[model samples]
Every structure is written in C-alpha cells, then in structure tokens.
Target: MTLRNSDFDEIRVWDNENFVHPWEGMEHIGQNERTFTETADGIYVTTEAGKRLIDGPAGMWCVQIGYGNGEIADAMATQARDMAYFSPFNNANSVPARLAHEIAKRTPGDLNHVFFTTGGSTAVDTAIRFVHFRNNILGRPEKKIVISRQKAYHGSTFLAASVSGKERDKGWLDQAQGMSYFLPNVNPYIRPEGMSLQAFLDEKVADLENAILEIGADKVAAFIAEPILASGGVIVPPKGYHKRCLDICRKYDVLYISDEVVTGWGRLGHWFASEDVFDIVPDIITTAKGLTSGYVPMGACIISDALIDSVSGEKSQGATFSNGYTYSGHPVSAIAALKNIEIFEREGILEHVREVSPLFQERLTALGDFPIVGDTRGMGLVGCVECVVDSNSEDSLDLDKTVGARIDHHCQELGLILRPIINMCVFSPPLIINVSQINQMFDIMEKGIKLTTEDLAVKGLWSA
Candidate 1:
C-alpha cells in the first residue's frame, strides 16, 4: 500500500502525541521535529522525500554489515517461521546454542559462557548484576562497588547507567548511588599540556591502581572499561592501557569487564577486539549493537570460564544467579547473529576492514588540519572529529554545544548523516564502505566543516 501525504502527516501527528523518544527532553516533548526516514539499503538511507544520504553513524554504530542485507532478512524470516517464541528461562533452543558456540570460539581466553539480553543496556546490566552476584556467592557482599572512567558511555539501564561515567546524563536521572566509582577522563587529547604521552599513560594507570588501593580492593567488584571509549567522542586511551589496567585488576583480584558494545563484531576488524586489538581478555565482555548488526535487538554478556567455575560445583548448594530477560536468546535474534557471523566469514568482511581502515583513518586524521577540528581519533572503522571553541570565553561550552549539530545539518544537506554528540561528530560507516565511498564521505565532511566554520564565524560564536 502506498502512503499518501496525509497518511504521513497523520503519522507525524501521532508520533508527536504518542512516541517518547530516547533521550527526549521535557521541553521538546510535543513539538520536536524529526526526519522521516522511509527506506534504507547498503549504507544509505532514503528520506521520506527520496533524498538518499550516507549513514555516517551506521545507525548508531550498529550497522556493521550495512542496511538491508538479504541474507540477514531471510535468516530472520526463516527463524520466525520455524520457531519464533519460547521461554528461554526453562528451555534451550538450537539457534542461540549455535550462536553461543560461534561467539565463544571467537572470543579470547576462556570466555565460553554466553548470556543473551534484549540490547546493550540489558547486557551491561546483566554483567554488573553478575559481578554483584558473584561477590555475594563468595560471601563478600561488601565487594559491590564498580570502577569506571569519566566520559565512558555504558548504557541506559539502572545498573548500567550507575556504572556509566557520562556526568551530564546523570544530572536529571537517578542512578544506584555509592555503587560505582569513576576515574579521570582517558582521552589522551585532554591530558595536561606539556605531559609526555608515556607520563600521561603512567598517570592514568596510577589512577586505577590508586583507586583500587584507596577503596581497598576487597570492596571493588569489577573495573568496567571500553577498549575504546565509543560514545565519549571515540576516545582512544594510551598505548598499553588495557594491558596495564588488566594487570592492575589481576593484582587486586578485581574482575575486568570490557564493554565492547561498539567495538565488537568486525567494527574493529575482528569478531572481538578485546584480545585481537586491545590484547587483554576480560573476565566479562558485554557486547551488542553489532551482534546482529542491528538487524534485530540482541546483546550478550560473555563470561570467563574461570569466573563461572568459581561459583559453581558444590561451592554452595542450590544457589542460582536468577537473572534474565524475557527475550534472552530469542530465536530470531540468535539466528540473525549466527547469519551475521557466517556472512563475516564468507565475505571476509573482517579482512576488508583491516585492509581499508588505513584509508579510513588517514582521512579521519586529515580532518585535524581543519582549524575547527581540535582532535580526530579512532581505530578500525570508528572515528570522531571534535570541534573546539575559544577556551578563553565563558560561553565555550555553550558555543561547543551547537558545533556538531551545525556540522551535521550541513552534512545532511550534502547527503551525509552524522552522529553529533555535543562538540564531536562521530563516524562508524558500514564495514563494507569502499574507497570511493570513503573519499566521498570525508569530502562531504570537509565541506560540512567548512560551511559550519563560516556559519559560526558569522554568528560570532567561534573563530579558529
């Protein structure tokens, strides 16, 4: 059936009245404007008016295999038709079982157990809960505090949000107080002005060790970290950071939870970036977004065999973790994940990412030459372009707030969509993006920045 203009208008009205979007503010509740995306395929989404734009953010950094893959769609349909819904709590299913094996074999170390969830938030929530559960099982109920870093984006669930260190997001929302401790920011770009990178690294590592020692390691349950802080403007920590942090965690017997929600499943040229890219096998790795390439909602908390064995087998009789979601290991999502893995292998997408990432990073680094771009950093397919204003002005934060959106607006007009986070424009294009498309994307981004710089100067908000 064809949708008429009136139908679209009615849909928009209904959306305004009924739909409460994620991260919606109170003032923008009923009068918010939004793009009506009509269709999408192959790294491009078509608007309602038939304008096709490159999905620069890759659908919130999830669309690894890109938009509208026939294989994934067929797998979802077949799984739905074969056996869609069943209680995973009391029963086991083949799709999830096979998918679990697929994930287990790819993950580093002995992280062989998989617990599925609906999405990233629930995955992180499950990981945190399990950490607490493990401590409780070991009779150390005081070991309930989680250590995280400033500006890290974990998830939106209660426990996950509690552990997340994005300060601005917590201003109006309530989180589990006193349950999480945050360290300083890890963005190397923000380190002290004359400090050597090695010294900066030492300071960051020292911060973790100090926190563990000061808090008394027995009270700290886990240190949750993103191999690369994705939502915190793609912040890449110093070299050997993860390995050093892992060492500190091991020294203090604190469990390490790697939040690879954005870095996994070929986004970093591997099925998992913990071992391959970051060189540390975490005790628990929470993954989503690219698990099914955002075809269907699914996430996982992959736990190490050692951690699970510590709690099982006669340690305490009749004890249960007793935590799960309704859609844990849903058949459709599991099958989709399996199919995603299959395509990654069959098409050599991981190899492609590794091969083309140099070009991606080169273009991203070149953006730093632009006066408005203060920093550009990334690895694999993910990247960020951060804009800076005159630091001397009191309105610096206010000026920075609109820089990204203004660049995004210009990029949209130029047929590219950006994920603007305050002063940063992040990019995680489809892993299948080619040389031509990469050039096109950065070309448009350059133009967008140019146009935005001109606009900012005209408005007297900033000048570089």
Candidate 2:
C-alpha cells in the first residue's frame, strides 16, 4: 500500500503541526520530518515510506502478542459493536467483571481485587491513591511518602512521575514534593568496586531500611519497584533482591507496590514476574501494556485482600473508596484483554518465552565482545546493551556523538528499530518473536554496534 506523495506530505504536515510527541524535542523533531508507521504485522512495522523495520521495543514494551492479530482486533470490534463504553463507577459491566476475575485469578497471593484504569500511568497513580486512601481510612495520614529507586520509570502522571526516579524526566516538571523518596537503583553491572553480589544486595536492602528509619516508618506509606527495571536500561537486580525488599517493606509497615507495567504478561515468561520470577507477593501489583497487548489502552491495579480487609470491615462506617475512570472498564478494552489472555493460554506464550529467552540472552550478551560495548544485561526476553567510550576506563559515551542514537540509525537502516536510552540500547521485542527472529534481531544489533564502533574509531573516540 504505497501512499501518494501528497498524502505523505499532508500527514507529515498535520503531525508536525498538531501531534505532541511524548519525551521528544519538539522543535528538533518538527524540523526533521517524522517517520509515520502506516501498518504493522507480526514483528515488522511498515513505515509511511514503505520501509518495513523489525519492532525491537515492542511498541514501547507493550505489544506482547505482536502486531496485526486479527482475533484481538475482532474481539475489540465485537465488543465495540455490542457495547463500547460504560461507566464502571458504581455501575458494573459483565466483560469488566469477568476480566477482573480472570486477572485476579492470575495475579499473585491475595491480590484478588482489580481496579481498572486507562493505562500504566493511571494504574500506578491509582495504586498510590489507594495507599493514601488506606492510610487515611486507618487514621495514619502522615504515612504518605512513596519510596522509589533512582532511574526507575513509573509513568508520566503527576503522582506517578513523582514516584519515578528518572532525573531527566523530572527536569522542568513539578512533582508532589516530599511525597516520594529515592533509593539507589540495583544495577549490579555498576555496583561499587570489589563489592560481592550478596554484599551489594545487602547494601541496597539496608539503604531502604535506613531511608525508612530516617524518614520514620510511621511517616512512610508505600515502596514501589519494578521486578526487572525495564526503561531504566533493563537493569536486573541481583538474586533475592526483591524478596529482601519485600521483607523490609513488611517490617516497616509500608505497602509494597510492584510496578510490572513493562515486565507483566509474557515479557518475563510468566503472567506476572512478582510471584513467578521474583517470589514476592506485593501488597499491590500495577500492570498495563501487555495486559491488552497494546491493542487498547488499559491498566489495572490489583490489591490484596489483606489490605482491603484492613481498610474495610465494621471499622469504617459507610465509607466509599471514591475514585475511578470513565473508561475504567470499557467493554472494547476489556474484551481485548480477555482475548489477549486467552491467546496467551491457548498458545502457551509463557512456555514459548521460557524456551527462547536463554538463546535471546546469550546472543545479546555476545555483543559485549564489541570494542565499545560496556555491558550487556537482561532477563527473560527484555535486554540492553550499554555502550561506553572506553570500557576499561568506564568513561561515559559522548553526548555530542550520541553513540546509542548512531547505533539506532544503523540498526534502522539494517531493517530493525532500536530504543536508544542515552548510552544504552534497550531491546524488548514482542514475545511472539521466535528463535530465527531473535537471531535476526541480534545480527542487526551486532552490525549496528560494529558500525558505530568503526565510526567512533575513525574519529579517535574509541579503539578496537
């Protein structure tokens, strides 16, 4: 489907004039024409210019089942035709009710109650609100501080952004100050020199304890973390880190919120990584993205019965939670999520991810042999390749050169799309990608990195 030059020109002009892209340099982006994605199928996205590139970031770490899934599309259509929108505020809908039941059944521990939202940000925002609400109901209004680790990307909402630790993201943005605390991210690759993995884990846990003590546990509300930090360069913490953190949260009476926005669904070879992969049952689990496979905008904050029980019962006299979204349980989105989960079960996507993840990790780790490759780290199907000017000296990549962006440029030309996060190139392809596809992805990545290294060496920025 080749578009006419006039059609392309009109789209580019309209997009540049009207569309406000997220986390982008608007002026720079407007000056340089945007590459519009016309269509997508399987793992490949066809641009408006008709160039098909493999989607390496899985449509912002969402599209778990891949693209052009007719069944999901049909599900949305059927629901839309039947009943598209309905308020889930006080009123109940069948699809949302059933979907909530299905989600609750799959979630860990007694996280049996589902509160639906528009997307990951709202899901996180809702969870934080619930924490505040719970504490308020329990007469502990001072316990309102939410602790999050540095470099963690929660969401873009006011409360969610406040909890997020990405410094660059919060530059000009105003967050709810004093409402959130920061902890050091558990990046084992950059852990202090000579510290054993166990010691590093202990130090991270101790830092949380110290933060709680310093802030006074009575004033702390909840602690939120990702099982595997996805947007923060795919930083996978040391073994048993989550368990220790959960224990600390429990000891400090802080509600533990597992932000599985990127790690949920089949990304980590499980329905939810908090229990299956990390072995920790958090008080609240916030999920989005793969929940509906990016088919529709949806997210859910699953709360444990224990927390609900604490705030409920005869203690509160006729009190309501008093919060919800208009599209909280939109039938179309609910049906899409339902069919998405059905496809996961019928196709055994989790088993497939587990089967292919080792090879995926191995191929990615092999890129470390490249001269500019500093470190390669990942778990499940999500991974990252960090580039440095000097691996031995640990010198940072030159921002002027934009090493990751250069690699992305090469990769895109070689039939792949890569997410360049500063010096790190992150990969979270669709879970439906097979072994051959994984190899193809890595082959293009290696070529890109090699090309970038050669360019750097020519400019005397690096050496082989």
Candidate 3:
C-alpha cells in the first residue's frame, strides 16, 4: 500500500502497550477520525483537512484556560531548567510541596493533605486504597466495601471500574469486587412522566439507608460520586439533593468522597464544585483533568484533617500505606499543574465562567423546545442534550451511534466539536469561552441536532 501522508497518517497518538482511548471503543479504532489533523490553536483547530472548528468541548473539558498560553509554557520551562527531576518522597522536589501547599490553600475544606498521581485513574486508585487503609487504622477494618452511584465514572482502575455498573461504554476490564450498589438519584428534569424529583430523592436515599442497615453500617467504607454525572450525560442534580445525600452519609458515618475529576477547577463555575454550588464538603476529593489543564499528566487525591488524623502515626494499619505511584508528583507534571493553577488564579477563570454562565445556560435551555431534545440541562459548562426514542416517551433512543453520533459528526462538519453522551450529545467548552463563543456553540450545535434528526429520519430512526 503506497500510502499518502494524510490526516490520520500524521496523528501522533504515542501507542505504547498501555495506551487505550479513554472514552472510545476498539471497533471505532480507525473510523472517520480527526485524531491529529486538528492542531492549530486559539479556540478552533486549523485542521490539515482545512476545517476551522470551534473546540466546543475544550479538548475533553480539560483545557480550562484557552490554548496557546505562553505563560504556562514558560512556567514549565522555568521549572524544568531549575529542577526537572525529583520525587516528593522523603527529601525530594520543592515544586510539588509548594504546589501542594498552594492547592491546600485554594481547596474548599481542610482538604489539606494532598497525594499526587499521574492521572484520574491513579488518583481514584489512591483514594480507594486510602479509604481502606483509613478504615483499618480507625479500627473499622470490616468497613472495606465501597458504595457508589450507578452511571458514575471514577476511573479505569480495578476498584473504580468495579465501583461502576456492569454495562457501560467500555468492556475492557474484568476486575473482581464484592461491592454494594445503590439506586442513583434520577435527574430531576429528565425523570419519567410519573416520577417527581422529590419522590426520586426520597426513594433513593431511603434505599441507601435500608442498604446500610442490611449490609451493616460498619461494613461500608465510603460513598463515592461525581458532583454531577459528566460522562453519563451531563446530568445536573436537583436542589437540596446533594445535601440529603451528604446527610445520609454522615448518618451512616461513612466517608464521603467527591470524584471532582470532571467537575473541579472552574468546570462548575467554582474551583471545587463540592464547595462552590452544593455547599457540601467531603472527607476526600479525587481530581484530575483541569489540574494540569491537560498540559501534563497529573491528578490529586485530597483528604480532610479528620481522615489524615486517622492514618497519622499508625503503621499498625498494615505497616506503611502500601500505595503511591512512581510518577506521583512527577516534577514536570507537578510543575505544569502548579503553573496551570496559577493560570486559573491569574486569569480568574471562574469569574469568566460566572459572567458567561447565565447566557451559556439560557441558550442551552432554549434547545429544550427542539423536537428531539428530551432534555437540555446542566450547571456551568457541562451540559447534555438527551435524544429519546420519543421526546414525549420514556424509552431512550438506541444507545448505538444512531442519533448521538450523527449529531457529533454533524457538529464536526459544521466546525464544532462535541461528544455523544449516551443518547445525548454533551458540551462543556473551556471556561475561558466568551459569551459570543457560547452563543456560536449553541447555534452550531442546534444545527447539528436538526441535521442528525433529519438523517435519522431518512434511516427511519426518528421517534414518532
């Protein structure tokens, strides 16, 4: 095959043995991909194919600050030149230590103790081990099982994948776990015709309480949930729902862990969504993505004073903590993350989100009138426009690419980027996006929806 150097031919996805496309499937390995063709900067990727597409999703919702920030590059450069390689163990890098201190100062609660990792999966893994270890040290070794909501994504680690439901996007991992599952709170707006938000929360919380009584309170270690379901379609929660969830966790004396990997760092109009909107705090906060603004690989597991106190001065809880990554607080990544945090502060990314959030949401909410739009909902930048088998029916559209993929592809053709979140296509553009850009995104996105519906109708996939 005398192959010409086309777009994908130049895609620089460094495929080591461990590389797996995070949210994509194996069957989609090489189909209609703009993998590396989209490269230029500042909002749109000036593709080799000559498309100037607006980055509606902010490169997987991690590029908090806009692209091409020389300040961030310079920060990495300065750190590398000063001290490139050093660990945070014993006597190691001062960069991570300083970064930790700064993060502690910025994070909501006394979530003061920071443990670093290479990415979200590692951050989640660390939280899993830490929860087990903390329980054992606190003399509740029986409390080893974890409780998590359905459709929540923690990470790809063994325990995290196990914590998620049986059927999901990927079918790669087969880890063993004897964990308990609870009925998740259904999104208020998207609830079925007969269902009400209050009723849903009441039933779901009651289920958790009953589950606790059955499993024994002392047997459960922690309750993990993303503040808002990002991957499972940007499902925005109802009012006072999180507070009740928190109250239930406290009632059971179970440690609450917020998986802020998606919602943190201005994604939710605040630094940490746990503190910003919900006014709820958790014992541990697992995070990544925006931490380094996707510049360098980094994640962090932040813990409260109480949990840290439980593990303090206790080798009796099985010698050392028996966890940590080789790249835990890698100097370059730590440097990048540290600089990225500074960028967030210096640029006031959250303020930008606050200023434009109302306008951003108003346009999305207007999409609710669309014939195929089951729901257009979310907080801050993260939002979902669910397509149903019937806009007025309870059944969802075929989870296959039918409607969602058509919309995503249509958006790509219209010079906009989006992801098909289950039956919904999601948009969580960079917090740096202006009001004008927000308007442009929804305008293009609506066009994509119309095109998708028309295409599906031609294929007879349209809901009656």
lDDT per residue (tens digit) for residues 1-464 in model 1: 65665577778888889999899878878887688877899999998777899999999899998998999999899989999987998899888999999999999999999999999899999999998998888999999999999999999999999999998899998999889999999999998899999999999999999999999998999999999999988999998999999999999999999999999999989988999998998999999999999999999999999999989998755689999989999999999999999999999999999999999999999999999899999999999999987767787777777898899999999999999998999999999899999999999999999999999889987666
Each prediction's TM-score against the native? Answer: 0.98, 0.97, 0.91
Best by lDDT: 1
lDDT at position 459, candidate 3: 71
Worst 10 residues of 3 by lDDT: 9-18
lDDT of 2: 0.91
lDDT of 3 by residue, 1-464 (tens): 23234624544343322356555566655453444444546666666556688887778878888677787788888878887777556557778888889889878878999999888878888888898887777777789778876667777777777676435643666755576464554467646679877877787667667777778888988888788878777766677767777888899898888889999988977889897788888888999999988878899999898777767765355457878877788888888887787777788888888888888889989988878787788888878888765444344445344678888888888889887765778878877888788888999988998887787677776744
C-alpha lDDT (0 to 100) for residue 386 of candidate 1: 95
Pairs clashing within candidate 2: none
Give Cα-based local distance difference scores for all models: 0.93, 0.91, 0.77
Q: Is candidate 2 or candidate 3 better by TM-score?
A: 2
Better of 2 and 3 by lDDT: 2
Ranking by lDDT: 1, 2, 3
The better-scoring model by lDDT among 1 and 3 is 1
Enumerate clash totals for all models, in the order shown.
0, 0, 0
Candidate 1: where is the Cα deviation over 4 Å? none
Instruction: State the lDDT at 27 in candidate 2.
Output: 54
lDDT of 1 at 116: 95
